[model samples]
Target: VTLPPKIVPRINICSWTYSPPHTHTHTNPLFPSDATLEMSNLYAEQKGKTLNLTEDELLTFYGILLISGYNSVPRRRLLWSDDYDVSNTAVKDAMRRNRFDEIMSSVHLVDNMKMTADPFFKVRPLFKHMDDINKTIPIAEHVAAWCKQFIRGKPIRFGYKIWSLASSSGFVHQMEPYVGSHTHLVETGLGQGPSVILGLAEKAEVPPSAFKFYHGNLFTTLSLVDEMTLRGDGSCGTMRQTQLHNVPFTAPKTFKKTPRGDAEYLVEVEKLIVRWTDNSVVTVVSNMEREFTETEAKRWNKQKRTMDKVRQPKCIQDYNTHMGGVDLHDQFVSRNRVNIRSKKWWWPCFNWALNSKDLLSFQRLVAQTLLLRHGTKPSRQGRRSSMAVAITDATRFDSFNHWPCNTGSRYKRCKNCGGRTSFACGKCDVPLHVECFKKDHTE
Candidate 1:
C-alpha cells in the first residue's frame, strides 16, 4: 500500500524545537486558581442548583482534599473527630465536615444532560476540557499503550481499568478507559489491541514519523508493524508466537528445549522478529530496528547458582528500556493519590487529575492570595472543637446517680419521652418522671 504524503517538515530529530501554547508572564502563584474556578463552576452547573460556593470555600475544599493524602483515616468523618490524634486542626478549621461532604458529593466536571452513554462518560468530560501543558520530549519516539487492569495482584486492584499512552519519561500523553471491544477505534483487520494504540495516538496528536511506539504481546502483531510503518512511524513490542501468521519461527515448546542463550530471527518485508531464550523465552517484533547488533544482559543461573551474562537483541533491549512509561506514570499517580472514598466512579479519575505536585503549598498559596486580595477569610472559622460526649450504656445504667428530687412549681419536658414532669435528677439536673427515673438513665 502507498504511504500517505507528509505535511509536517522532518528536521534533525535532535534539534527540533518545542513551543508551549502559553508563556509565563510572571511568577504569580494565583494563576492556578483559574483551573479551580473552572472546575468549581462546572461542578455547580452539574449540580443543577445554586451552589453558591465561593473561591475560598472551593480552595478550602481542595486544601482539605490534599491534606487527606497525607493524613489518611479509616472513616472520612474521622478527620473532624474531637480526638486529637484522629482529627486535623487545619482541616477542621478550614471547613466543616458537612460542607466537605457536600462538595465532595456534588463535585463534577460535566453536565448530566449532555453525558453520553459511553463507558468513559463519567470522566470523559474532565479529559475533554484538559489541555496538554507539561514539558514533553520534543520528538516523542518512545510511545506505549498499556492496560492498567483492576484484577488482583495489582496495586490498584479495584478501580477503573484504563488504557494509557505515555512517553519514555513516564509522562502520560493520553488515557482511555477499557470498554471491551468497543473501547477503541475499529480497524477492520487490526482487531482491538492495535486499534487502541491507534486511537490513543490519534487523540494524543502525536506527530507522524516522530514516534516509535512500544507495547507488549497484547498489542503487538505482525500486521500492526506493517500498518505503523506505512504511516511513517516505528513499532517495537513483545509479540505472542501465535500472532506471527506466516513467519516460520520455531514453536515455543520446541524452542524451550534449546540452550538458554539460543536465539533466532527472521526478516519479512522489512519487519524484524527476534526470539531469544534467557529465563524461559521471549519473542519481539519491530519495524524500527534490526537484529544486527546484540547487547549483554545479566540473568540468574538456577543450575550454576550464579549470574550469567547473555547476549540480548538490540530490539529487546530497547523494548525493555521504553515499555515502562505507563507503569512509571501509574507509580507516580498512586504515590500520593487522594484517598477520599466516593460512591461515584468518576470521582477516582477526577481526583487523580486534581492531585497537585506541591500538595499543601499549591492550595494554600492560591487560597491565601485570593482571600488576602478580597479581604475576606474562609466562611467557616476555627472554633473550639469539643468532643460530643457519648451517652454510653455504662453511664446511663449507672446505679449510683439515680436520685430524683422535686423541682419548683413549674414542670419541664422529660428529656427522653418529652413528658412534663416536676421531678428532676439530682445529679444529671434534668427533669424526669419518677416512673422514668430508672429507664431514663439505664435505657
Candidate 2:
C-alpha cells in the first residue's frame, strides 16, 4: 500500500478579500453593508435581475467555492517554472492518457468549535524564506494526494488528464531528507482554484456533469428565446442549431413590468448531474427578495462547527489575507488573460469562462471532476513510474489505495481503462493480479 509523494508541497490555499455592503440597486444582489466597500459600484451594473455574477465577476464567487472544498478550475493560475518544467506537457499528456478516478476534493467538513476550519486552512505558514521551505509536502505530497484520489488502483492508459485548482499563493517542496526509506511526491500552487477540472472527463471513468443554469430576469429569458423562435413550447431550430438548450420552465412568454418599475418573475430550468446514477435532474430554483435569513445562516454556522477540523493556513505569508474562501480565489488564484476589451465602462468587466467562479460553474454545470488535494510524483519504482504501463501490461491491484509511502501521503489518477481495471484486487474481483503487475512493471 505504499503511496507516492505529492508533486505540489504546500497545501492548496486560496487568498481573498470581500466588499463591505451598502444599498443594492434593484438590479443587484444583496450583501451586508459591512461586507465590502466595492459592493455599491459592482451592484450598479448588476445587469439583469438574475445571474448574480457575469463571467468577469466570477472571482468573488470562486472564492466561495474554494472554501466549499471543490477544485473549481480557475481562469488564471500561478504555475511555477519548476512545475511547468517537470510536469511538462508530455507528462501531463501521459497522466491524462491514464486518468484513473473522477472525484475532486471532498466537501468541506464541519467541526465542533465553530472555528470554520478545513485542513489546509489550519496549518500555519512558518517558513522564513521560500527556498528553505518544506519541499516534499508542497510539491510531491499534495499532488500525490490528489493523484491518489483519482488514479488509485487503476490501470494506466494514454490520453487522460490530471488537474488541480485552488485560490492562494501556495507552495510545494521536494521531500525532506531527499533519501529515505519512503518516497513522497509533491505539488503546490502559489494560487489555486478550479483550474484542474477542465479536462477531467477525457481521463476519468466517471467524468464531470453539467447543471442547467437559470439566471437573469424572466423577461430577459423571454426576449432572448423569443428573438430566436417564432413557435411556442418546442425547441427552437435556431437555438438547437446553435447548441443552446434554454427552454421554458414556467411561463413561455416574458414578464411585464408594473408601474412601480418592479415585476414578479421567475425562471426555472433543468440541468444534468450525476451521483451513483445517470443524468440526474438538477432543477435549480430561486426567487426574488432572496436573502439568507438567520435560519439559513444558522444552518451554515452549524455546518461550520463540524468542518473546523479541516482548516489550515496559507503557504505564502504575503498573500495571507482571506475573507471566506471564494474571496481568496478571486484576488489571487484566478489567471487574468491580457485583454483588448472595451473600456467604456468605469471598471473592468471580467466576463468569460475564465474567472474562477464561472469556471467553477462550468465544472459543475458540465460535471467536471474536482481535486480536493494537490499531488505527488513518487512512484513505486521511481519518480513518474510508467514501467509496465504499455497497452499490453497487466493491471496493478494496488493502484487505488497504496499505503501512504510516507508523510501521511498517497496517490490516485483518473486515467485508467474506465472502471474496468480495478487496481485493488479485493475492492472488486477484477482478474488483474498484483504479482503479475509487479513482475512485469517493476523498475
Winning model by TM-score: 1
lDDT of 1 by residue, 1-443 (tens): 32222111100010001111222111111124455456656776665655566667766676666557666788888887766668766666667777677777666555566767687865665554432432232434554566656567877587666777766555555666777754645464687667877777776676667467777887777777888888887787787767876666677888777777677777666777777776677888788775345787887888899998877778777778777666665665566667777888777777766652333455345444443443233475444445434543445566775698998735699877888888888877778888888878876
lDDT of 1 at 303: 87
With a 3 Å backbone cut-off (N, CA, C), the pairs that clash in candidate 1 are 141-212, 396-441
Off by over 4 Å in 2: 1-164, 167-198, 201-246, 250-327, 333-443
lDDT of 2 by residue, 229-324 (tens): 221211100111112233322221221111111112122332111001001111111221122111100112254455222211111111123212
Quote model 1's TM-score.
0.70
**lDDT of candidate model 1 versus the reference:** 0.63
Lowest summed lDDT window (length 10), candidate 2: 272-281
Report how far off residue 42 is in candidate 2 (Å). Answer: 48
Residue 257, model 2: lDDT of: 16
